[model samples]
Target: MHNITNGPKVIGTKQTLRALNKGIVETIYVAKDAQKQITLRAQELAQSQDVPIVFIDSMEELAKACHVEVKTATAALIKN
Candidate 1:
């Protein structure tokens, strides 16, 4: 969370999925309380691409950590 706050990051399910497919993201953060449909897909993609997925408690917690007002189901930390 701290790392993403200080660096490049893409938030939301669609954006994170694109980043994962493009292999631009080094790590992914998924909200544990997110919808199963969304989280499962993201997790599968991360595993297929060998990207690390860090699970956070909830969308509220994750969004707060990212300094965003809206809840975020997922986010990806992009490489430099």
Candidate 2:
């Protein structure tokens, strides 16, 4: 599998949702302490789209994975 963890395709919640609707998202990562409603919505969206979801321990971890300083949530969209 491609290492999107440090690639240029990482996106935030809004963009992620848009990508999800387009069937471009492969997986989503949510911070453990993220808002319940947001996480739930993301889960529902991913489930409906058949995309995988992961919950990380912190925003810092998600940021690291996305190669950013900090990220509350993100989704790794399919490359091309």
Candidate 3:
């Protein structure tokens, strides 16, 4: 059984990025087929924040993890 809640942290781009910059991001998961620019930005953000990045098989999985319907990309920022 796959569980997004127990899997990892999840965040968006705009507001979420701010949180990430504040050291709230633990790990990030992007859709494998996400936009190149968005993915690149996420990569950069993760790198700058020293967070790990992973590409899941589908956006659906990422969305579900983010508690959305169809999110193209998402960042896992959990509070420690």
Report how far off residue 53 is in candidate 2 (Å): 0.8
Residue 72, model 1, lDDT: 96
Q: Write the per-residue lDDT of candidate 1 for residues 1-20, one digit (tens) a residue.
A: 35767779999999999998
Please provide, for model 2 over 1-80, each residue's C-alpha lDDT reduced to its tens digit, 9 standing for 90 to 100: 22557554655777777777777777777778767776677778899877878778877677777777756565564646
Off by over 4 Å in 2: 1-3
- Lowest lDDT block of 10, candidate 3: 1-10
**If the candidates were sorted by their lDDT against the true structure, best first, what order would they fall in?**
1, 2, 3
Between candidates 2 and 3, which one is better according to TM-score? 2
List TM-score per model, in order. Answer: 0.93, 0.78, 0.73
**Better candidate by TM-score, 1 or 2:** 1
- Which candidate number maximizes TM-score? 1
Judged by lDDT, which candidate is best? Answer: 1
Shift in Å, residue 16, candidate 3: 3.3
**Predicted structure 2: lDDT:** 0.70
